[model samples]
Target: MDQVPGSPQEPQDARGDDGLPGCYRHPDRPTGIRCTRCDRPICPECMVSASVGFQCPDCVRGGSGTGHAPRASVPRTIAGGTIAANPRLITMILMGINIAVFIAMTLDDGRLLGDLVMLGRTPPGYLPEGVAEGQWYRLVTAMFLHQQFAHIAFNMLSLWWLGPPLEAALGRLRFIALYLLAGLGGSALSYLLAAPSQPSLGASGAIFGLLGATAVLLRRLNYDMKPVLILLGLNLAFTFLWPHIAWQAHVGGLIVGAAVAFGMVHAPRDRRTLVQAATCAVALLAIAAVVWVRTLQLVG
Candidate 1:
């Protein structure tokens, strides 16, 4: 048989009486090809094409040596399917829920504005009522309700801007947890500080939380933070200066968001899930403690 100059020459033992050699990896299979580097018989499935000829799996693995890096695994989820690890699915779902709730409120009141406002004076034991009266769900529901077009518009705009990137970074579940906890933090603070007759509603708390988280993530990545810091300062100024803005929620969310983001970014890779869970638990407990103290004050 005519042999190519650069091609590997088959070994004399490559063929047995049957004119085929058993595969080095799988003795049951017969093969006509031998590895160029190791000169071992290899089946087609175990063959890796090389410049001169096919190489066996062992030879290919050996050639790569200790420098061979394993391919990264894509995670389908990180937090029990509460959030997806990739894309902005959770952000869109949140935006949709908020919009739907706003529409329902508008229909009920037949007004473009002031339809779903949660007031402090809202009768105790009623839905959307004050936390002092055991209407604890208000802490979560209020985050979804908005008073007017401009109100929902601004909050949704901010959500759209900040949510996607953060969601991508933290995965869906973690981002959702952060958002809810931050909003709860805001509501807890507002419940504690605002007068019994004072009314508050909106997703500003969650938005502010996202802002704070973004700032923390940027700082951790060593990116320039001047732009984010300036934006945060302006929003905080507006929170304090604007009338009926629920600055308490803004402040509360900001603080909680920053704390959560810090824990998430600094968590060790091996113990990430446990650490994240603990961090979330601590945040929830802190908010609950505030609520407990406030409840006692109100009852007294």
Candidate 2:
């Protein structure tokens, strides 16, 4: 028989090879501690330290009617993230950054775009600039760079529309992670496919990522998917048909955004934190690999 946490008895444990009990939520994780309320095994991530023995997430949320809850239990989102009073905080910050960068570029006599735009590599005879020459920051800076008013307006509007719900659902940290990773994914793909000398700059890739995440979120919540689908379809059409558009960035961001959002919304409750962390890690590794391969191709 298993014993609850702080039990005086040293009971035999049959559930684990090491004579320890496995967590109810994550059976693979062996632990001696159990939730005081339910006497259920709990791992470190699932256990919340209290005045009494550690309580599980369920117990903490339900209060267990034993006064084990915190003074003020924080509200949670659908994705198990802490709910924010202002769901649009991250969205507004992102918009501000884009706007600030645009303003700076506009006031700088139009010379800043050359420095901020994405450039994979310059030819051997050309100046020693771009990613191959160790100017890798372009991959990031390009995401925030925009030269035209129409470009910034369209992207900022899209961010305002799509960013708040995602920021709320995934919480600030995860939402920012999704946005940044999607942008990097777009930059990497464009570097790999486009001409080394080609200059590309815009928030389109990250915004496209938001669009994909919005679609995934809608599907997860069982909301009507037709609206998002129609919107995404229209954008894809524009991506292909429009002149001077880097379709690679649009395609890459959409795929990466959808993938990260799927992981965020569909991770199992017992192992959600682990799953979300793993999902972001995997996406990051993929982006690094793409950049590495492209760097090799550009320099070689």
TM, every model: 0.71, 0.76
lDDT for residue 245 in candidate 2, whole number 0-100: 94
| Model 2 C-alpha lDDT per residue in residues 1-300, reported as the tens digit of each score | 222344323342447766677777656657677777777776544555455455665666666645435632864555667756577888999999999999999899877887878988876777537886889899999999988899899999999989986886778888999999899989988998999888878999999999999999778655567879999999999999999999999988998999998998778777888999999999999998999998887767
In the range 31-93, model 1's lDDT, one tens digit per residue, is 666766667776533544443345554455446223333322232122222223235788899
Compared with the true structure, the alpha-carbon lDDT of candidate 2 equals 0.80
Best by TM-score: 2
Model 2, runs deviating above 4 Å:
1-72
Q: Provide the lDDT at 177 for model 1.
A: 90
Number of the top lDDT candidate: 2
Instruction: Give the 10-residue window scoring lowest on summed lDDT in candidate 1.
Output: 74-83
Off by over 4 Å in 1: 1-70, 75-86, 110-129
